[model samples]
Target: MTKTAKLYRMVMDKHVCPYGIKSKWLLEREGYEVEDHHLTTREQTDAFKGEHGVETTPQTFIDGRRIGGYTALRAHFGRREADEGGTSYTPVIAVFAVGAALAIALSLFAFGAPFTVRTAEWFVAFSMAMLAMLKLQDVEQFSTMFVGYDQLGRRWVPYAYAYPFLEATAAVLMAGRLLPWLSIPIALVIGTIGAVSVFYAVYIQKREIKCACVGGSGNVPLGFVSLTENLAMIGMGIWMLLRPTL
Candidate 1:
């Protein structure tokens, strides 16, 4: 049985356009049947507004699915198909990278002079970068990937807290240089989470939802770049793990 290409209607007027022609260009590339219903009259604009609140041209409909606004439309198509899965190397590589990043991060605090604000600040910056990257890469999926917990609901409550709590801990340890051994477990936990996120983002593209790792409005969509970054962190962590002593 041949599956029909889903019909997507986009009504765009010149005045209240979103992304201008850029939105249309992207929609066309995504195989949408785009028709620019340019509304020149107040009556036309009003009628269009009545049908869909906010008379914005470039309003997208995917087989009757009203994906309003340019941002929403981008999100809809940018989402990967649920059935797709990640590459074989994604998880293994990511784990190694995260592990290594943690190890190096921990060492920074330990090796640096104690009670120095400079060292503390450096560790803070490094930790911030790592957390930003993880959030960008959608680290929230780690719980489901490694622990088999429900991505939704309190059954997977621990993963919810792990993202920030552990990140802060990693940074703290790196700054205080306290119990470098503690870093090993923390690294392991972060690596496990990162590995899972890479796996799902690559393979189960659509099923994986965005991780608002950073609290902000305009989130970057999760993709392979994120996976590779997480993988690098894993490698850094592994290097640290093998070091003779913390």
Candidate 2:
């Protein structure tokens, strides 16, 4: 006997239900032959909901048992639901991915070169500026998280607020290869402080904490990524200062 499932989802002119599509795809992936049904009109959807005594679209049934919505289907299949406040690297990964793409695009469009040392430079600067932008959105919240681990942020309240601005300014100037005298020192000082703080807190003390690198609203973990950000910043600073010699 073949396993079978039935799915009903909304497919409207303005919007198609994403969860509905996901449910159908998931059923198919799990080797279920799905009888896909689309509630094209609001009235039809309402009638179905009223008849089933349910409140949402994208209902699924397996072996004549009502399996609820997409989340419910995931539960039925024993997949872990994403915790809203759980630690994740998604935000940082997204920022880095976008920064790298932007760097490559800038290199190709402006300089007509695909791969250059400048591309690497732009990627670091762009990630720095983007991360700074995230922190600047909520300085109060960011400072709360930052002071938890950063030695300087704990000693000076103002440094927590000023850190984002400093990072952004240095990044913009460094990307332009302008005002190296000012940018290099700012980057080096902050980067050195950040790297040491992260190392001590996460590696030495074995303390688990949230990172302020992508701002306070995110749940990005304070570990390798936070260290990587600081090391990249420091590397960029040193490279910019000594590039003429190499």
List where candidate 1 sits over 4 angstroms from the true fold: 1-155, 175-177, 205-209, 216-218, 244-246
- Encode model 2's per-residue lDDT on 178-228: one tens digit a residue: 899999999999999999999999999999889999998999889999999
Residue range 38-122, candidate 1, lDDT tens digits? 5566677677778777656556665556777566666777853333333233333454455456545555666753444343334
TM-score of each: 0.37, 0.75
TM-score of candidate 2 relative to the true fold: 0.75
Per-candidate RMSD vs. true structure? 12.2, 3.8
Residue 138 of model 2 has an lDDT of 97
In angstroms, what RMSD does candidate 1 have relative to the true structure? 12.2
- Note the Cα lDDT for every prediction shown: 0.50, 0.93
Measured on C-alpha atoms, candidate 2 has an lDDT of 0.93
**Worst 10-residue stretch by lDDT in candidate 2?**
237-246
User: What's model 2's lDDT at 126?
Assistant: 95
